[model samples]
Target: MNERMTKQPKAIQAIIFDLDGVLTDTAWYHYRAWKALADELAVPFTEQDNEQLKGVDRLNSLRWIAQKGGLALSTAEEARLMAQKNAHYLELIQHMSPADLYPGVQPLFAAIKAKGWKIGLASASKNAAFVLDRLGIAGDFNYVADANQVQNSKPDPEVFLLAASGLGVAPAHCIGVEDAVAGIEAICAAGMRPVGIGEPARLVQASLVVPQIAALSIAQLQALA
Candidate 1:
């Protein structure tokens, strides 16, 4: 087990969230978009392929799909495919309004904010702003670090660190909530507490693990800080 897993802190001043699996159910949307592009290109991909792309930026995700299928796409081809995928994603997301907010997300955001702790978003997706805006929760965050703003993605700690810096908070005073192994690793690398939103066994490196956002309470967060 990682050292963070051995103990939980009792106070936190900031909370950074991963946008895809943690904040919304849009992971499936991304999966479908990528899968469709793979099929159109005559590339083989499965749900398992989607797993490898988790927490990676869109361009990286497309490149992974092509590489895994032994397809060498030219820069132009790659751009076209990425554009196609984004178009499909935008259409799919149009149906998502504030009413589509995930279970416990609203209450969790409100509860945390009420405690006067800063809130930030750290996502691998460049379209994070659009997603959050469509969900009507864009204003909830005080800072956002998306793929376009960072040179490195998850497992590099750039995005998380950027969010911490943007929020004017030290990494040690922040808690990162993520659902991917890469995201957890990034949070740890940034020297912040990590809360995994999945099976605890799967997130054995996280300082705290919850099955879902609903499982986290303001009091529990305070106690863990």
Candidate 2:
């Protein structure tokens, strides 16, 4: 584990989290869903394609698929394809429950709540509710801002900003936790500090990066505020 420290400060008012890779090991679910759709359309898609779509919303992923397949899809067609992919993902995640919650997630969430910070889910997935329900952590968050609410996704800051606005917190007082480089960029652009949960080298723009939430503590996080 890598260790770097920030000076401690007053308690944070709110915390926003990215759902997929950060809160659950479902990034591969998205990758497989996209790949299945590509196969159905006879389009070539590699892991690199999925990587490019990281932190992008489902509609954008469907648009990318249409673009790469050279298939001109009308808005209706695009929506249909997106619906198909989400159905597949939902089925695949049907067995997921609180048992699938990442190591240390429950404890960390309880700790933060005890400290009086409002929690919010800020995911790029249009199926954010589905995943949250699967993990059985839906009740932990005061607000959830999924792809449906944002006009622009990560690397654009709209999603994160929306989450903060919905939580009635200033962006500067909110700390965004994410796992993708694009997510880190969005958090920074929203004028919030970002704590990245993945390989530190993969999260270059994060204010602080840790291997996982397991490595973070309430005190350590408060320091970033």
- List candidate 2 segments past 4 Å from native: 1-11
Estimate TM-scores for all models: 0.92, 0.89
Instruction: Single out the weakest 10-residue window by summed lDDT for candidate 2.
Output: 1-10
In angstroms, how far off is 8's CA in candidate 1? 13
Off by over 4 Å in 1: 1-11
Cα error of candidate 1 at position 75, Å: 2.4
What would the per-residue lDDT of candidate 1 be over residues 153-197, giving only the tens digit for each residue? 899999999999999999999999999999999999999988999
| CA lDDT scores, all candidates in order | 0.89, 0.87
Model 2, range 98-176, lDDT digits (tens) per residue? Answer: 8777899989999989998999988888888988998889999999998888788888999888899989999988999
The true-versus-predicted C-alpha distance at residue 45 of model 2, in Å, is 2.1
RMSD in Å for candidate 1, one decimal? Answer: 4.1
